[model samples]
Target: MPVPVGVIEQRDDGPLRRGPRAPAWRRGAAALCAGALPALAFPAPSWWWCAYVALVPWLLLAGSAPTRGRAALDGWLGGAGYMVAVHHWLFGSVHVFIVVLGGLLGLLWAPWGVLVRSLLGGADGPPGAGRSAAALAVVPSAWLLVEIVRSWQGLGGPWGVLGASQWQVVPALRLASVGGVWLVSLAVVAVNVAVALVIVSAASRLTATVALVLGAVATGSVWAWAPLPAESGAAPRIAVVQPGIVSRAPGSPQLRFARSEELTRQVADGRADLVVWGESSVTHSLATHPSLGRRLTALSRTLGADVLVNIDAPDTDARGRHGIFKRSTLVGPGGPTGVTYDKMRLVPLGEYVPARRLLGWVTSVGRAAGQDRVAGRRQVVMTVPRRDGGSLRVGPLICFESAFPDMSRNLANDGAQVLVVQSSTATFQDTWAPAQHASLGALRAAETGRPVVHATLTGVSAVFGPHGERVGRELPTARSASAVYEVPLAQGATLYDRFGDWAVYVAVAVVAAFCAWRGLRRTPGARGGLLRRPLSAPPVPPAHTVHGSPARPGR
Candidate 1:
């Protein structure tokens, strides 16, 4: 008969056996799947509730890993899975390089994985209540640190922030008004940690349950107690024109421009205070193309309102250097109003290759930009004449700029009454990218207490109220149309806008305090504080029973 692992067999010579370990491949695949699960919480599937538990599988795997090295590997694989899943749509444009980028970015999570294992299990079997409680704060703080590091514009920006998954949840939006998406992400990760402790550590079950209850209470408190934005009493009808997909043949710019003009004329109804076009609506710079300027001026005169158009064209600076700029220009009855905001943040590889001299070869791969686009020096808030004889301050964000929360908050701080994001996802019309891009406006609006207008060239143009509520029907990709949204203006700032990433600061402090407490635990005299271990000595191993026993000296 075969002897089972971990069981003692009686024979001429007795020995104990241990079970064979599971293969590394199986654990890695599980980690990858667990990491990808959170992407479902974003757009398309938009399973917001799934985000609350999406990290559990990964956390459990990391926590139970036999060694710290294996746990780190788990974190890397999981982070890669998450990056690929959330950005899978880019595969259409970025091709096979998306996988490589995902792997590189996944490195940011490796330390996080090791941290999880250390706090939850380490060499000991399961964590006690003290460690379980620390995990609630430290784990989320570590996650936030990763988020903040990866949120740099060069690092693909903050496209899939975990808290953004709750854009549709009113209570979550209320929390966003309090602390921006960072706080929401912190709360979400905390809940996941608490739940994992509840499932794995019976001794820490009460502690985990208390954390969960506190998260719920805090969210509820924000919803009930946060101050509301006062209405500015200047609701303006903003018209967004989507040209849909046009031919990519020669002269495509003119084709898109003509189509946008036709749609604007059809939808304006002379009631819109301002007519807005999507990113790259004008292909030719007005300085170089007098006729294009004449046409836009005529359109503005016919609509009886100023027009906001995005220009994607090359321009020559005073220094005689020429570069392509994605600029938002305002046109009144006159040709050009000189109120312009050039796009400051460029898409990493899509708009410009970072460290171009070293990485310029990427342009030969997939669809990376051949020449880097010039960045604007400063953000501009334009004052346009509202049809009611008062001026409205408009802040314009081009394409990827809208993904940044700080930019919108800065605009609100600069006295922008309405926020407009002019974007073109024509290359990704068939994918979920358009919908995902549009969803960001709601989060931005909720964070800054300002109405946001997301105008897209191909599809998925949307408007959100000051509180992140949808203002009108979305213009999806299938239709070539225009829609006017009555966007409400608001006064006063959201706590997130006022305090600016206070949640991140608090998280940093928590992590620092925890680290200090941990460092102090090693000292002989410093172990009697709040997180005192009930029983410090390691558990004694089970006594070995020897049948008949005179052993050899070597044995």
Candidate 2:
């Protein structure tokens, strides 16, 4: 007979075998899980496999650890692996900063390991149905908390969040309507837990498997049953211009400008109501350069569509401090609207470094030239008149600004019929950044119940309908391409749009309560009136202390 590695040794009198080796299948299972986790981060337009399998290794390792501490360590290792693999793209944008950022972000998973170990009872306890169900709730809840904490402004990069891995999974996406992205994240985690349980134990495997299937069915049913709002009959045909400038390297500015002009000219003759350019399409300010403005005016007239252009311009506020603004300018039809929306939510270091005065001397730490950029005061929804004489209100979000849910919601709530995100991902080209950035538009669409048209300078520029469905086609990143998409004016609003993050608040409270309950239960003397005072309280010190020691220390 084969010896079991993990099984405890038994004496001649005991019912169980002694010093047996752990089952070979269990160790093989764990190894398989560890190897499969890295790939979970990127799934082509279909990532449901990640939702079903990502947690298996953690589950298997948790089962192998004989003590709570060991289980915690195993979980932490899995978490670190998952985070580092998924966020590998961060290195491309901030290569030097990656080590510092990755380490700080990796800490977010440390507690997750501890929590999972405690919830599952050191992996050695009876793997009963009740325990399995509890695992489902606890694991997902832990993940949701980590995501919420990391998504905050300063803690970590929220890019490639686990929920985003399910971008193509329509059923999982329905959860976004209830609690933004966190709910979807929760559902994915829950499914993973259920799947892990079914794989580990045979006695209750059927039950666990059935439960997992039911959960998925429930998700799909929600998506199918959820009432989709009516879309307005008016459809605006918009052309997105991607003037692919592979390198934003210094000295290539003129080349980039020329390329932008060429692509704009190519699409100027299309049936576009409005020609939209990606962020930084115009490197110079149109207001300051009448020559550029005239050129844009001429393009609008020739194309017979209003040209919406984004320019990185210098603006001086009341204090006479010049700051760079990723400004969006509307030119065409009615002539120079002079209306511009400055980009908010700037990328740290990429756009402007934080604490620049102290860090500016570091050579790589200075703000992008033309002074530090100031964020826009509000979301700007510009009304662009269609060639058919009808006007379509477009909410303009610039580059990194599109990642924020509330920012997009504010625009839609303020009567933006279509959300337009003009972005330039040239700096972080060929990485997951473009694909990850593109995924945000779908969530934004789900949140506001509106279609979002994202036009990027490089690639992954695409359009999404009200229900977060992809429309027309997506352009590849880092290439010169133009796509015309007929986007519908969606009517009605999502529950999340109306209620905002209230559900998140409720979830936080619930998790907090559970943590508090667990903490209290773990305290000595809290259960069965077992008031076990420390064998004897430490001897009280004398009334007065003398110099380094108490007067009656020995007494």
Candidate 3:
């Protein structure tokens, strides 16, 4: 057997692993590479399988650290890489503050790296399969905890979650039904740990192989045996109107109206049961603006179907003159239907500035759009009038709102048979943002066990079945036109919809258990396996003779 490589721990300022360690710059670069490697698994490049091994380098670096502080630095730098790579699109909008966001967000992983070093740094851990298995389980669990915490909307929302990288992976998408994205994330992290274990324990390769095999088996089993969604009702014919219009700064009112009107008419010419226009397609509301409302009313009558459009307009209530509210309203053949859904979740910097009082100084970084948009209070499940007989229950979300999982989940739970995402990604059409935004429909569909229609303004308009399989050809980004699709309706809630975020709870439990285990190890008598630190020097032997006299030097 190969000699067991000893892990060195430097309690004092000394050489690491019996030698001078590499310079801090080299180590920092390694950490950054570890963090950024996973970005390839996301959109644009979209190397989906890369997520399974993306964390290996960073994890190995953290585990090799001679001290917890060093390990934390390693993890932080790695996290900074991930944050910067995943959200680089923010650079166009947030400007230099993208660096600030990455730096701040990267801090979330420092303690995580410290924990990895503390538990699996191999100081006290014996060279055996047990340690390998523990690493395989514990590393992913800890990562799940980090992903869950980082996903909190206040930080940045769940933009490029690890599991989301597997949007195209059928097995991974199936796992999402039972545990949400957290389950898939856990599986991916475990796979990475297994790969690391195999490399670290060349002498004891069987354990590592077992871990890798088990991960594959579990993933395959989920894909083969997981529940599939059942069709709940009749299919609805949906047509998306892409005006091929680009807006840099909301140029002109008449121009916007005419464009939306002409394009919608072209698509809605009695072709489908419902017609969709991208977010803010109708700059004014039918309720407030009569001229715009009259034209839509005539169009709806001519089409003999319901016309759905988004409106961003100011509303005056009893409280005071509040900011503009953006909502989607459905127009009936006769006139305006009161059925409407307001966007619940608002974009942080794009829609409104957060902490306007303290950090309001960021106006110099990006073009500051005056007046924030107000958010809606509750979920709205609109019963859209169909060309057939009974109406189809649909839950509509605006551009940025689709990113929030709860928005879709709440809609599904509230009797929404189909999920519709209306977006205008003209701002980042040329970039990866449009495709990334459109792909979220797959996850939402799998999670809620409902068909999802991602109808966008420019392009990348796609549809997914209840099980997240792509329904038809996805319209590419940066292009525009009218595309008609027959969206299938599915019934019955998945385990995720019924028991929401079970995977997150599992992650929390795993984290709590790991913390408790670490605490137990630090206790006075905790064995701590092979990494046990000597509390005091081994008892000094008395220099004595056999007859109780001082022993000689040879004795």
Residue 244 CA displacement from its true place in model 1, Å = 0.1
Q: List the candidates ranked by TM-score, beginning with the highest.
A: 1, 3, 2
* RMSD of each candidate relative to the true structure: 5.9, 8.5, 5.4
Tens digit of per-residue lDDT, candidate 2, span 1-555:
343665544321112334555774565445334634744555333455755676766766665555545555555555555665665666655555555555556567667766665555442344677667666766777777777777764444366567766666566556776567777777777777676776666754765787778886877777776655578877899998887864557867667666766777787557789888888887776657778888778778888888888888776533455778788889985466777787767766666656778755433532233246776666688998887888899999888777677787788789898999999877667666788788888887887788899998777799998878999878977468777888987787777778887646766776687788665645365344322222333455447655666466566
* Candidate 2, position 276, lDDT: 88
Q: Candidate 1 or 2, higher TM-score?
A: 1
Model 2 root-mean-square deviation: 8.5
Q: Give the Cα error of residue 325 in candidate 3, in Å.
A: 1.2
Cα lDDT listed for each candidate: 0.87, 0.70, 0.77
User: Count of backbone clashes for each model?
Assistant: 1, 14, 3
2 or 3: which has the higher TM-score?
Answer: 3
After superposition, the stretches of candidate 1 with alpha carbons farther than 4 Å from their true spots are: 1-18, 317-321, 522-555
